[model samples]
Target: MYILQTVVVKQVLTEKMKRQLLLSYEEQKSQLQREYEQLRFEQKKAEKKYKNSKKESAQLYEKEMQKRLDKIQNIEFQVNQLSLLPLGSELKEQELQTMTEVNVGDRWSDIENEKTIIIKDGIIIDIR
Candidate 1:
């Protein structure tokens, strides 16, 4: 009878040890799952921050490029205005008269004859 009692006690102790070991394993697994979820949340936040920064950078670049284009356009407009003015030291009043007075309805042949006469006289004449 004593031997039987000892066997039952040993079996009970073995079963208790198995239950404790299973509970410890489950706790470890639960802790690891929580850590994994936290890491995923942190990664998502970081990605969002990076995307926002990239968008802001692109907008700034666009604004800077537009400013440069506007500056160039203004400079080009000023250059064009400067080009329309007359050049050289001679003014309009200083120009020599090179044409003889001709009335309206003058024939082309008459203009040609006048040009020949002026050429022979060694004087340059311009007829329109």
Candidate 2:
């Protein structure tokens, strides 16, 4: 009885830890997405300002706009990379699984990204 109780307690703790891990990953991903959105907004603002600028100011604003573009691109890349995690994934990896049994609607998520593999007739048909 004591052993069974301990086992149940251990399983509960394990599940709780898994939930925490999932939450942490979600938080990180959310942060990245928020940053990406903010960067995009800033870029838009910069573009508008650039458009309204005079010749010399336009050249300066153009430089600033280019820098903003690079920053936005970097943030987008970060967000894309963080999109995969314990919460959900849709990325397709190079590793092949030995187990072949799967239904048409069965979905397997990537460990690193928001990519999911679509299985059709016991084979992986697409990754989305």
lDDT of 2 by residue, 19-121 (tens): 5545765676566556656656665676677765446554654566566566656655655555444432333323433333344554433222333455433
Error of 1 at 13 (Å): 8.1
The residue-by-residue lDDT of candidate 1 on 1-128, one tens digit each, is 01111001111113343345346555655555555455455545656777857655555545655554565555455445434533321111122323444557766465444221111122323222
Best-fitting candidate, scored by TM-score? 2
Worst 10 residues of 2 by lDDT: 1-10
Off by over 4 Å in 2: 1-13, 52-128
TM-score of each: 0.30, 0.32
Best by lDDT: 2
For candidate 1, list the clashing residue pairs, or say none.
none
TM-score of 1: 0.30
Distance from true location, Cα of 121 in model 2, Å: 40
User: lDDT values of the candidates?
Assistant: 0.41, 0.46
Q: Count the clashes in each prediction.
A: 0, 8
